[model samples]
Target: DAMVIQNPRYQVTQFGKPVTLSCSQTLNHNVMYWYQQKSSQAPKLLFHYYDKDFNNEADTPDNFQSRRPNTSFCFLDIRSPGLGDAAMYLCATSRDVTAQYNEQFFGPGTRLTVL
Candidate 1:
């Protein structure tokens, strides 16, 4: 099936360490998004790629960064992992979320543990 997939369902990182989470999709959607979810909190949008254009949310911290080398792959890089940074990283894709009729489809997500 054409769907989004995230690798290393679980991840562990030390304080100040750098970690990278990956996502890939067969859906061939034009928009790819990354979101962070903490316990008891709604998922926050970090960034997204609409084709080759990258859009990062204003509230996204400097510690979070992303890369989309191509349409099928996207990567989230944490420059410095903090204890508070532990959370689930979700990867999603959509044809066009802004359109009146478009919607999003998400991956299972990567759970990060700061140690």
Candidate 2:
């Protein structure tokens, strides 16, 4: 089945370092999302870009940024990582969340560790 794919499943970075997580989709879905999960807590939606339109969550940190160059690729950039930034970064996709059947497919995620 088609799904979302994230690179560098395990990432270790020093404090204050910059990191970038890559995400790609084989399903060619219209909506792409980025999320952060700390420990056992529920994943928090950071932002998502639909086609060329980008929408960010009201509470998302200013340190985070995203870019979707085309339909198949997206990237999450963390300008400066702090100790609290360590978590599992997830990438997901769906046709449209507002639609009746908004089935989102998630990638395995990239585990980021701040040293």
Q: Going through the candidates in order, what is the number of backbone clashes in each?
A: 0, 0
TM-score of each: 0.95, 0.96
Once superposed on the true structure, which residue ranges of model 2 sit more than 4 Å away at CA?
Answer: none
lDDT score of model 1?
Answer: 0.94
For 1-115, candidate 1 gives per-residue lDDT tens digits of 9899999899999999999999999998989999999985899999999999999999899999999999999999999999989999999999876776269899999999999
- The C-alpha local distance difference test score for the whole of candidate 2 amounts to 0.94
* Cα error, candidate 2, residue 57 (Å): 0.5
Per-residue lDDT for 1-104 in model 2, tens only? 78789998999999999999999999988899999999989999999998789999999999999999999999999999999999999999988767674788
Error in Å for residue 26 of model 2: 0.6
lDDT of each: 0.94, 0.94
Query: Candidate 1: deviation at residue 6, Å?
Result: 0.2
